[model samples]
Target: MTVPLFPLNSIVLPGGRIPLQLFEPRYLDMLTRCMKDGIGFVVVLLRDGAETGAVARFHPVGTYVRITDFQQLGNGLLGITVEGESKVAITRSWRQPDGLNMGEVEVLSEEAYAPVPETYAELTSVLVALCRHPVIQDLDMTVDYADARQVGWRLTELLPLDKQEKQRLVELRDPVERLSRLQELLEALESG
Candidate 1:
């Protein structure tokens, strides 16, 4: 299916929530159509260039997201909260006349439910503590501490990992492998 692509330097994995402001004309139009049609859009990680003006290069794998809440901020910008639904692969992309990026995409398969392994169980505990922070509580994320997929994704999003590292994790289809990678990264973080 074809969907609008909102490229950013950051990556949001499935089950993650992100707030964005719509001010660009093309983006504003895209938001209107998506909300009216009750469809979602793809948030791809920008590989090069900027988010506005010229067309930017973005990673093929992206998270399909739907607008969950919206408000007109006091500054007059339209603030919208979007929740990630699933991962999508962009097969082809092009810019419209108004500079909005559109893409032909296929939704990636969801990870099967896998319980967190004993070795990485500590990661889940860390995630639980991170979620208790007021800033994270505001996102209202539904995380299952026992599920490997949930534990991997929530930690990958909440951790101070670089954008490329997060994108790599988001593209991974295996929950266990993702968790293993996170554990290794966390270990290295502690050592450094």
Candidate 2:
């Protein structure tokens, strides 16, 4: 199905949340339509350029997300928290007459992961710590994860990775592999 696209410099994994500001006319309209239709939009990583005006480069892999809560910022911009639903692949994309990026997207199925294994106990424990960090405190992060995949996505959100690294993590369809990569990255982080 076709969905409105928001290409930003950040990647949000399934079950993660991202705070967004809607001030541009195109996006403000998009947000209204989404809220009215009870649907969500796609958020892809901006491969190049900015979020507004000019058409920017985008990663095909993205997360479908819905606005969970909203408030008016002091400057009067629409501030909203978006919760990721699932992964989507952009089959094709084009700009609307109003400059909104619209895409024909495919909803990707999530692969089931086994429960968190003992090997990643340290990694899982650290996720709790990561959730309480000041930077993560604002996202309204969930501190509990039932499975390794949940842990992977949450850790993916918490880690201080570049956009490219985050895109890689978001694109990985295999939950176990995602967790394994997270573990490796955590190990490297500790060693560095």
Q: Best lDDT goes to which candidate? A: 1
Pairs in steric clash, model 1: none
- The worst-scoring run of ten residues by lDDT in candidate 1 lies at 9-18
RMSD in Å for all candidates: 1.1, 1.6
State how far residue 108 of model 1 sits from its true place (Å): 1.0
- lDDT (Cα, 0-100) at 119 in candidate 1: 91
Candidate 1 lDDT over 12-39, as tens digits, reads 7788888888899999999999989999
lDDT of 2 at 153: 85
Q: Worst 10-residue stretch by lDDT in candidate 2?
A: 140-149
Quote each prediction's TM-score: 0.96, 0.92
Error of 1 at 69 (Å): 0.2
- Local distance difference test, per candidate? 0.91, 0.87
Query: TM-score winner among the candidates?
Result: 1
**Pairs of residues at least 3 apart in sequence or in different chains that clash in candidate 2:** none
